[model samples]
Every structure is written in C-alpha cells, then in structure tokens.
Target: MKKYLTQFKPFLVFISTFFAAYIIVTLLYKFYLNTFETNDVDGITNVVGKNVEQLMDLFNCDIKIHKSIANSWLEVWYNKKYLVRIVEGCNAVSVIILFVAFVLAFSGKLKTTLLYIVFGILFIYILNVVRIALLVVLLFYFPQYNHFLHGTFFPLIIYGAVFILWIIWVNKFSKYAK
Candidate 1:
C-alpha cells in the first residue's frame, strides 16, 4: 500500500489541486451570477456580447447585439436576421476556469504560473469572441448545420485550443516538465 501510494503521489496531488481550483472558481462565478437580477445578463456575458458585436462590425458585417428585454441573454442579429442568443455560457469563463485549474495543478514557478494564467485567460477570451463571431456568420449561411456548428464544431475548437495549451504547459513550463 505504501509503495502504491508513493508511486501515485504526483497524480493524486494533481487531481486534488485541479479539483480544488475548479470548484473554488466555479463557486465564485456562481456567486457572481447570483448577484444579477433574474432577467439581467451577467457583466461578463454582456461584455462578451459587446465584443462580438464590435468584432463583426469591424469587418463591415451588419451585426447588432442587444440585451433581450424578456430574458437574461443578448440577442445577436446578423445581417438583420435573428440568428442566436449570447448566453452566460457563451462567455467562455467556464473554459477559462478549467484552463486555470489545469495550469494550477501542473504549476511551475509562481511568476510563470501567474503569467501563464493571465495570458491563457486572455487568449481564451479573444478566441471565444472570434468563435462567436465566426459562428454567427457560419450559422447565418449554414442554418441547416446549427446543431453541429454550435454543439460540436465550435466546442471542439475552444476545448481543443485549451487542450493544446495544457500540453504546452505540461511539457514546456510545468514543474514536472523534463
């Protein structure tokens, strides 16, 4: 038993740190969400929606995003067509949380970990905004593949990026890196 425990000590530590960071951050996010009114979108989602709107606008695309009067989401209009709603889940904060947790688990030096987390969060946020914009354009042109685009393709992109980041951290930056 002691031998087994010794062999798996690193794995156990990683799992514990990952879960601890994930749960704590998630709970903090939940508390933040709870502060919003029932029919109001949270600030982060609102910012994400605005960023998407601005991004599309930069390309001269006819894009407009407005807070839905009857719900806690932002309505995205592309080329004057009601295409989708930007919900809290669309903000990518959850993905950032997961990324942070993994980075924490495989942490290197304090300065490196903090810097990586900041940059990683920014990268994910920017990628998410661009993803939403691209998704809007794609959905507008390919309405038939909404499920595949939203449920599978875009998720694969974001999560794949995160996975790549994790691999980079583990191999090149984490304390365990050889």
Candidate 2:
C-alpha cells in the first residue's frame, strides 16, 4: 500500500489539489458575485435583450451583447448589436492551473517559487480581463467571426499564454536545482 501510494503521489497530488482548489475558488467566486450589487443579467437570447440595454447604458455604447447556445453551453456576445452571453465559471480553469503551478514550486524548486506564484496569479487575472475585453470588441466589429473567435482564437491565445508560463516555470525555474 505504501509503495503504491508513493509511486503515484505526485500525480495524485497534482490532480487532487488542482481540482480541490478549482472547486473552492469557483464556489467562492460564485458566492461573491451573487452577494455583490453588480448587475447580473439573465436569460439573454440575443443582442437586443435587456442585458444589452444595460450594457449599452453602462458603457455608453450602442453595441450590445449577442447570445448563443451551442452544445448546451451559453455564450455571451457583444455586437454593434451582436449577441453575448454571461460565462459564469470559466475562471476555475485558471485558478486550478495556478494551484498546480504553485504545488510544483514546492516539488523540487524552491527558489523564486513565491514570486512566480504571485505573478502567475496576477497574469491569469489580467489575461482573463483582456480576453473578455477582446471578445466584446470582436463581437462588435465582426459578428460573422464570432464562432471562430470564441471557439478557437481566444482559447488558443489564453491557453497558450498559460502554457508558456508553465514551461518557463518548469524549465527555467523548477528544475534549476536551487
């Protein structure tokens, strides 16, 4: 039993901690958002819905949020009257990935670990905000390209950024042997 556990300890830790942190952060964020006074839009089907009206008033833009449902997943869209959907739980991915990286910091490399985790968290948040901002802009300017932008480009860019950070950590920092 001890041998079996030790053999898979790293993988176990990685997966378990990653998911645990993901769930905790996601729930906390949901709770926070629900408790906050910020506007929460619901059941939008297209760009002309009440949510878009609110967005327009808030941003002073004639642009709107376009809405779509693909594979049963809702997408919030923005348009020069286009559709947008509210994505409630995507931040979990970044938080889990960050947690995994933080765990790796203690695995074999302790040097610069704390600093890396701090910057990693900051970078994740900033990147997500940028991703949201870009999506809104793209939805406004290029409605026809919404599928590709939402389905492919943004995911590639954001995941690619995270991947690069992970690679830099493992190669340059993690295996540095102190």
Q: Which 10 residues in a row give candidate 1 its minimum summed lDDT?
A: 49-58
State each model's CA lDDT, in order: 0.97, 0.57
Model 1's lDDT to the true fold?
0.97
Per-residue CA lDDT of candidate 1, range 26-54, in tens?
99999999999999999999999999988
* Residue lDDT tens for model 2, 1-178: 9999999886787677656765676676566556633344332122124433464456665543333433322454343443555444444344445555444533444557667776776676566655665677777778799889988998888778777777777667764334
Candidate 2 Cα outliers beyond 4 Å, as residue runs: 37-111, 175-178
Quickly count the clashes in candidate 2. Answer: 15
Residue-pair clashes per candidate = 0, 15
Give TM-scores for every candidate, taking all chains together and pairing residue i with residue i.
0.98, 0.57
| lDDT over C-alpha atoms for residue 144 of model 2 | 95
